[model samples]
Target: MKKIFIGMAILSAGLFTSCSDFLTEEPKQEQSNELTFATFDGVNKAAAAMYGMFQSDAWYDGEFTLMSELRCGNAKNPTSVPGSGRYRSDTQWIYSDRSTSPLWSYAYYTIARANNVINNLDDKVGVDATQQQVNNVKAEALFIRALCYFDLVITYCQPYNYNATEDDKMGVPLVLVTENGKPARDSKENVYNQIVADLLQAESIMADDYVRAGVTDKAATPTKPAIQALLSRVYLYMNKWQEAADYATKVINNKKYELAPADAYAAMFSAATAPEGGEIIFEVYGSDKNEYWDNSGWAHLPYITTTDDKGSHGDVCATKDLYDLYSEGDIRKSMYKQHGNDYFPTKYSGKPKDSDPKYTNVPILRLSEMYLNRAEAIINGASIQGVTAESDLRKIATVRGASQTAAATKQGVFDERRRELAFEGHIAADYARCNKSMTRKDFDDSKNKDVAFPSYMWALPIPNRECTANPNVAQNPGY
Candidate 1:
């Protein structure tokens, strides 16, 4: 499927919080100035732009991992760049330093884009677009906004306070409407409420018509499945285990998405050739033409390399502990390459020399995650022993025909998730939801093996620029 650009209608300014300048470039006088959200095509383009924000390193490659490390108790040393570069070798990363962090800023950038869509969508001047198109666009925008807020809250603010009222807790900023002026941070409860409202609205709007097998569907955008997947994640974070399990089960059995075969896990990551694997429900697809190596998945993930077809940059190898989690006879073990006694994932290796490295779109949500989630939620909600009660947990585990049977214990499922979903941006969040202790010692002994957690993970201080722009905002705890 040919990729579509959303903000093509909006002028591409460097950065702006204004609704008018959100996605569209300034309209050329030659074209009619009266374009409105009346058609599927126009609205679809705007929806497409939301995904672009994810492709940018500002959101995914850089800020995304930085936030994960914060919660996971992994940080680099003060002498090194705090959050940039391949964290392949032994480099100390400090979590306290404000200089090297871009998370808060990048999150706002995404929020601004989402705000632009929400604000301008209802005002579309054209009538050709139906109420359904407008609703779809709005729902998608809401979904994006909720996702960004959830991302910000988990990293910058404290975890969800189920006991507090929406206005009392300290949550991240909630920019529902686009603003030309500065805005203050909203309470954490307010942010959560807004996220829930947005997701509910998205689920309703999406209904059943928004199914897309891959990135090919021209009308591709979040569907009921995507919204449910996110809600499952949100509820899990909020400690609503039964709700999380229920939502996750809905997706797992929905027939809209499915888990990929364990044997195909290696090939599912190939950028050029991997068929849209069954595991993916939604993703931010990127193209070599539109993206560069530093920002591309092919360039950043270490396992996909040239010489070994399993190693790249000879760095960022999977942790020995993580590697060992897989048992003998587990076919997924083949996904990693252990050349020269070092283990690297084979998932993202670039094609052989000179050939354009295929860049598979990163999976934002997948069936495997939903399965793991169901297991966790069920275990958290009502722990039961044996096959009948532990059925959900067992279904996800024992894949690859390994000796490690499905675990009835919390540790078993948790360990299974770490191995099954390694490096896909789930580890830290999973740990947080589970309320596991995140300390420097854990990373040093595990993933990083030799690295210590920098104080920065407590929360990267809000950027100076943001504080200067909006004085009401306060820095996170210990930052």
Candidate 2:
């Protein structure tokens, strides 16, 4: 594994009084691991830091989200709008070991932090914390580690079903504990099995309504539903159709969440605080107060999707290919605003304040995805009583004011997923896992417009730094 090195600075208890403050605060200096994980407060701070680390540009705040869209057909760089020239290589499918995303290092850094908490939770549970409290902490760490591994495996390895025999295919390294020893990549199936095991363990420990204390934004933390929702996605990727459908049903049946209605759909994305109890299962909290916020600057998603006149980067725009997918009365069409000849997504249209673009929350998982996941699974031969692919798809289509035409078929479910989850970072994986080739008609580069299924380019190259540091780590094919 890549060297797991991070300063062990436990913030003062006063620093994490609430979610906003907890997410915004940065650790000052290195402390000993013994002191950092000695108390419940200390362990809580460590878990909070794990959530905060996701705001880095390499992860949710920028590249991880935008690159997925850019590489797929949903996003484009408009010639009319001025940009920072970011994501151009991704849009054109131009990648190399050096040019590949920095998500690898960032994810490992987060996993290491989570490992620190998970490894120490049991031993430290006595005076300052109860067993239940320690369990919650461990659950959070497990969820974070599983999420990071899922992202790494999907990015650095082919789809779970890429080959008939999975033993030959390698996934990213599985570093369950914080250690410095270099490790070779595990098989894709082993990596997925580990993810499922972690999530299931987390789900068992956490209460159905367990929300982390001090979190003002419930979506920032992992609740039981959130874990189940992620399991649904993971199962879908693993081609466990029945399991995927069942897990999606678990999330969908949870009355705590409901899909955002048509009128509130666009606003959900732009809310300064993540919207509570409507569609959002998990989101990356964005705030000017966040330590990484200022550094993100023009590279942020809000800036990239907004207009130049709005005092943002105004680079990424919605292609006609995606825009045309919505019917005449579909409310999702309103999420895009045209400037000259370009149509920019208003999904990240900034928050309510003057510094709007800087503090916009990014949704990571939502209830709409559960419906889509279930719908896709059912269409692909999953069984759920009283549920047809059409009915589940209509659950989303009705809210978006879209008519359900051909939602009973696999192609229709895929189209609905693209329509519902566009630019949220599902497109590339959806295409790859479903074995569908991407043909971008609206893209300018004709030579590189289409990405065929089963291509080696589906898996990104492992970082050169990782390869240099760990001779055991092998680069992905066709780097």
Candidate 3:
């Protein structure tokens, strides 16, 4: 867990390269950290760079999202042998020390960048920035760090409630500061506690209405509601049912967001920008104008999920197991389009005019998810006055033109979640946290069609490079 420093040359090329409308200015490259953090302008540029890191292909921009769906029954490779040779390993649940996800390295890289911002904020806060302005930046940094850690823990460690002794299980290293040291893995309990601490402290200092300046897609930046939404999800993972329901209720009660109507459901994701007053609470902003656009070009999710028509890759396809869950009248059922014999999800189908599949924003959180989270929480012994689990579940079902007959039951809620959140990337994590084995009935590969619960494969291996470099960091049990 030693800090991975971004070389000045690499930082100049990647960090300063602005995503259109998200960042307004690019600061001159300075050779030293002092010059970079010396002024409020410099600090602001650094914060923008931290935000830009989310667009990396290893993280939200593509693989992480696609892998989540592919590993679960929600998605599959269209052919037993991948035609494009993309997502084959993931769809087949193949993992080795050398073939693990790059997310471990990329997530830690982003965390190190966030640590730089958090560590320097107090000393650098001067006449250039007000106290409140500095606090907002710090809050944003904390939120980003928490998010990265949460992803790392879920991917590299077993679920919080995996067993009676799960709390003592090894989690990823907790690197809260920018320093040179090989840190060992922290316990699962300690890692989750750190995530909660970071999020709660961020919530205390950030303004409810504060949006980062110069960001065209406001949901890309962390807001009060965004923090709450994440907390709801995190609590649900931790099995803190009451807390999960309460936090979800906070976001659901907010007037800033509303569920997109059934007619506009598909359009909401395919739009260039998030629709105003739409369901998206947080998303990774994608744009053709983004200069650091390496991930969005050909290897983007839109290309992977689309048909070969219009030069797209068409590698990932929706499983019949998932497709059959949607009833005939449900608007969500229309989110898929058939090609040959395979069904591809249209959630990441790029903007209408785009010749290539790029510039499609990726939704990380939405209002519909809040409804799902609360419903799951309520079904597991949490209570809300005048709001049964059925009522919360119906909120989503009604808007999407689906039947609510399956509401109020745990399995029903889980099935509804798969239908509502498919391809947006919650499937694998949902199954793992709930201690349910994945059953991919439509997959062509017989050997991996069923992944048993509590298997070591659920926790992906640490990247080989990290294990080689950091002696103190341990790989997960399977690898």
TM-score of candidate 2 to 2 decimals: 0.94
Off by over 4 Å in 3: 1-14, 18-21, 26-31, 79-82, 163-168, 289-292
401: Cα error in model 3, Å: 0.5
Tens-digit lDDT track for model 3 on 308-348? 55777788899987898988789998888887678888888
Q: What's each prediction's TM-score?
A: 0.78, 0.94, 0.94
Looking at model 1, residue 23 earns an lDDT score of: 29
lDDT (tens digit, per residue) of candidate 2 on 1-479: 23443333333332232234544444433455667677777777767767765776777877888888889889888877767776777777788999888899878877877787787788766877888888888998899999999999888888998764443388878887666577888888889999999999999998666788766577888888889999999999999999999999998888888888888888888776667668999888776666666654677778888885667877788888899998877988888888888888887777777764465678888998988888888878999999988888777778888864545888888888878888788888898899889888788864568888878878888889889888888887777
Residue 350 alpha-carbon offset, candidate 3, angstroms:
0.8
Residue lDDT tens for model 1, 428-450: 65654454554443244334333
RMSD values for the candidates in order, in angstroms, are: 6.8, 2.9, 2.4
- Against the unseen true structure, what C-alpha lDDT does each candidate score? 0.56, 0.79, 0.80
Worst 10 residues of 3 by lDDT: 4-13
In model 2, the runs with Cα more than 4 Å from the true position are 1-20, 23-30, 164-168
